[model samples]
Target: MSAKLYLYPGWLRLWHFSNAILCLILIVTGLSMQYTTQGDSMISFQLAVSLHNICGVIFVFNYVIYFIGNMVTTNGKFYWRNWGGFFKQAITQSRYYLYGNFKGESCPFQVNEEVKFNPLQKIAYVAIMYVMVPLVMLSGIAMLYPDIIIPELNGISGMFLTDLAHIISGFVISIFLLIHIYFCTFGTSATSNFKSIVSGYHD
Candidate 1:
């Protein structure tokens, strides 16, 4: 008989679901923005920009809550225990994914509250939360400020920089989403992992 596992706390569930929605919106609006270039005005670029920005702002604010909650462990979590365990788990987990798991082998590490997030997950989420998120937000704000914030950004050079950064940020986020979807099936029950992110519990 399998035992119930309490993987997610309430705040993590709240953040995960809300963040997922924001990401979905960003993806759709981003696509819409590109679509306008082909003369398809069904989803106007201006409107998408506004929606994306507002959602981005909400996400950023919530992310701050995510950080503080982690610090307090009010949610019973931390990104990882320490640098050493993090690296060790990450490498072992990567090897598991590459070789062990495909052979129907057992996972190298069993998860619990303290050892949550296999190495690969830790690395991916850390990168997405730390790097990709900030990069996108910065580029988004820069785009918003091309006219008033900086003379360099308002002109051709600024436009090029902001567009390149924004597109690159979007590309990274898209890759993360695809990887996340593919890896979601790795849990004991196929849908349990996804459900945990929504409901705050895993059984």
Candidate 2:
């Protein structure tokens, strides 16, 4: 099999990993902050809340920077462009992962600048970044200012809704994180994808 070298690009790797770690920090700290435990603590409730907030701010910074900077790259186009093909690609890739790839077949979609994602990736990346990511951020931000939001929420309980939204969004992201890591192991060397993200070069 011939190998192609398309350097993953440094900024993309930096943003991806940094964003991931910060987000995970938020996830863990957010959970710890939410539940009031009277026992041993990974982090004190007060400290968890404070750390979560700080991590959140860092996450937001990374989020905005990446969104603006990589709007033209896989970070964006992987979701926005050739949307019809996205659905088709998703179906085919799904089949490959479920059955065909086990038989050692080549990937259904080619990887190139013009056609980057294999359907599954477009939907996953898009949903995570565009849909779910914003939802979590919004609800988390709202939770940060329940008093302010409560007044505006009027009649409806903002705390209940915001907490629900935050929990649901966090669940989705947690699942995405799990799946992301699993798929990363399915690459050529069982670590090619991880290496790609780290070194910005998939070999």
List TM-score per model, in order.
0.85, 0.90
1-203 per-residue lDDT for model 1 (tens digits): 76667778788788878888888998888878866774567678889888987887887787788778778874534465545766777778888899999899878877775667677877788788878888887787777676743446445576777778888988899889999998888888789788777776665
Residue 15, candidate 2: Cα error in Å is: 0.9
lDDT per model, in order? 0.77, 0.79
* Range of the 10 consecutive residues with the lowest summed lDDT in candidate 1: 74-83
Prediction 1 global C-alpha lDDT: 0.77
Q: What is the lDDT of residue 97 in candidate 2?
A: 92
Q: Write down the worst ten-residue block by lDDT for model 2.
A: 145-154
The C-alpha stretches of model 2 lying farther than 4 A from their native spots are 1-3, 72-75, 152-155
Off by over 4 Å in 1: 74-77, 85-89, 147-149, 153-156
TM-score of 1: 0.85
